[model samples]
Target: MSKRGSGLFFAILLAFALILSACGNNNGGGNQGGGSEGGKSSGGGDNKTLSLLTGGTGGTYYPLGGSMAQIISDETDYNANAQSSGASAENMQALKNGEADIAFSQTDIAAYALNGELMFKDNKVDNVKAIGTLYPETVQIITTKGSGINSVEDLKGKSVSVGAPGSGVNANAQQILEIHGLSFDDIKAQSLSFDESTDGIQSGSIDAAFITAGTPTAAVESLSAQKEIRVIPIADDKIKQLIEKYPYYAEDTVPKGTYKIPEDVKTVAVKAMLVVRDDMPEDDVYAITKAIFENTDKITHAKGKLIKAETALDGIGDLPLHPGAEKYFSEKGVQK
Candidate 1:
């Protein structure tokens, strides 16, 4: 062949090769056909990958998500990746954009997204599904005993960390203050996570900060051991209205011994749920949920979430439970 003809053939071959590679990555495993079968079951396969978007690496969500990945992998055939993200709100947005397959998010965020309320504004996140409620994220109010910060009202003029932008904790703190006629400008503000806020408290750069996490969070554990930190609970009557406007949240208590605090701390809280997009295959969702539930010991115990495997699915909303998860739950009689 002529040199020009040879060059033309080579160019065509390269283009075809690139197109083939792209198609191969997107459509997925030929094993998809054999995914769901008999009572014996098949947990998807090695080729199927699901993503779990979690909060800051220093926070509970990250470790919880990592533990989930491990437990699910051991119990199912699907490979999971627990990705570090900007927390609840960010994870919801990522879910809408298909950036992740599953995520750990606050109950308030899921409610707001589904209802198109508050931060959701015009864009409604209509496809969110809940697998289970992990545990309560207590809004921990830490203050220097000498800071004269006795209540949420006394936070005025005191340093506070609202948490990182786009995080669920920050959003909840914003709602709590606004309902009570306060604003970021009403107090000294610092954008930090539980760990960051703990560091600030240790160094005395801030007088108080809000933390939303399970009991005995490592950061709080360390801080409580050092400073004479107090757990100021959010037990205001206004919380009833907050919960009315958003039903996803409920009343929870930071028990007397959860921290070094001497008394039970009452607070408004929300469940942390593992969410998924609408399009994930039922078998895939079921297998993932099953793996996590069956290996609950691996996740909750590893991360110290203070929970049980079956307890996770206890309070799911009307949002259609993934069929696979439903199948498992139904068999276990958890959904009766």
Candidate 2:
């Protein structure tokens, strides 16, 4: 039992302690780098989780976005959760600010964001890109049967709901009114949400409202069930003029049975589309696009039926499509 033996023993003990510490550090680092359970990986991996920005809970975008998110989760290695926001304009901003991975937007509003027109004027959001168009969001000029508002011109001098402030619907209402030779100044403009507008109409606080959503919109349908509603038809010439000026619009019709209207009503509509950040990987966007279109049947919303690959490019026009989405559409022979 000499000093040499004691020194050797101490050195071996220190070396063993250091080795254990290094092993524990490696294990701890691995666990920390690993993602949360049932969550997307922080490191590069096949699975990812994304946030989808949609409109308010009372609107079509919210429920439709939920369905879309579910579809992506079920069909791909991605988990998407839909979040309710202020709809088109806000959704665009979310994409621009990196707050959201994907979003729903109206074709016209998206065009404006790209070109810095109207609401987006002088503040263009160029970092967003399109996935594909979903369906037509019709501009249904709704009023009670006895409101004496059978046409757009009648809306003048009446209390009207022009949609929520800074919303795509607000922009649409403005354009439609301008085409009809009227402006917000010409009417008692009320900035209200869909539910608010309908409530105002029911309470006789507003005479009419301009709703821009897929036909059979929940708000309008609820109003129709309680009171006889009329959807004012846009005259052929005005429709022509509106389309000529705002090329995003296309001729559309609300069939007779919709809202229990007596006959068909002609109008113009913009397409609702999915948009994403420009920085998303091409393959991820492609998979998302594929999952949405290929599993439309799984979407329970009535508008789900309209989400077809054949019409994905309908009102997309010249807006830049995400390369991933473009690749998927091209493979399906659905070209822009």
Candidate 3:
């Protein structure tokens, strides 16, 4: 072969080799079939990942979030995963920073994030939007049977676990105390999580704890199973005051069988809410909201509580509803 012809053949061969190498790379989980079955096209830049931010490992949010992630993955093409977080306040920051796609938060905290109140202070997170309201978490003021802390007023001059710092529970605890005309100076306040607070109660280090959670709360239930405890009732007058000032506070009754109480206890509650960033695709968010409510049974089975689709629109405060969620609820004939 001529020398010029040989050079031409070599150039063509090099180009062919580069094309084969590119094909090999593409076949190695690139654009085509990269995600697992039922998962999103995460390997490609066009697909968005669904990350659900939940509370600590032992809390209700974590397990419920895991269940929700599974539902999203099974019901939609999004790749969803649940992450352990510090709950409400922290989840809000995560969503705002674009680090998470969905989060579980207390309605009051969501309001605060939206309006720049309480922990949010002067800097507000305006990008957050509500998907829907979940179940109500009763604010239970619990102590040992002999603690003599029968009402909110009795918490004065006592040691109290307000809740962990930077958490929505902490804000609720402070509100309840303030409504009772007591301040942190009136009591020895301890910032602790539910498990930590219960541990303090068990060890006799804490006098009382303001626990905001669902009825038959895991921590409170465990405490009741091992030792007798008292759930202080919030008087109707106090409930009225709380609701008057904060419409997010709702009336809830902890049934007699819940915990060690023999009689039903009256308390105020905050609704748990699912939230998303405002920039999330409306259609995707709509589908997620619909999937969650439409398959309430799946959530109930995973979390052991009935979530009625009809009540989803009831307690979602003034926090702006995601357009997608609003559309879904409207289609169900439910209006906010």
Best by lDDT: 2
* lDDT digits (tens) for residues 43-151 of candidate 3: 5544346899988765678778888888887776576899988889999988888899899999888988888888888768989899988888789888999888888
Off by over 4 Å in 3: 1-48, 300-305
> Each prediction's TM-score against the native?
0.81, 0.86, 0.84
> What's model 3's TM-score?
0.84
Candidate 2 on 47-91: residue-level lDDT in tens?
567899988666789889999999888766677899989889888
Encode model 1's per-residue lDDT on 20-50: one tens digit a residue.
9999766645444445431224324344566
Tell me the whole-model lDDT of each prediction, alpha carbons only.
0.76, 0.88, 0.83
The TM-score, computed over Cα atoms with residue i paired to residue i, of candidate 2 is: 0.86
The candidate 1 region of ten consecutive residues with least summed lDDT is 36-45
Error of 3 at 187 (Å): 0.5
Error of 2 at 187 (Å): 0.3
Badly placed stretches (over 4 Å) of model 1 are 1-46, 236-238, 300-310
Error of 3 at 52 (Å): 0.7
The residue pairs in collision within model 3 are none
Worst 10 residues of 3 by lDDT: 32-41
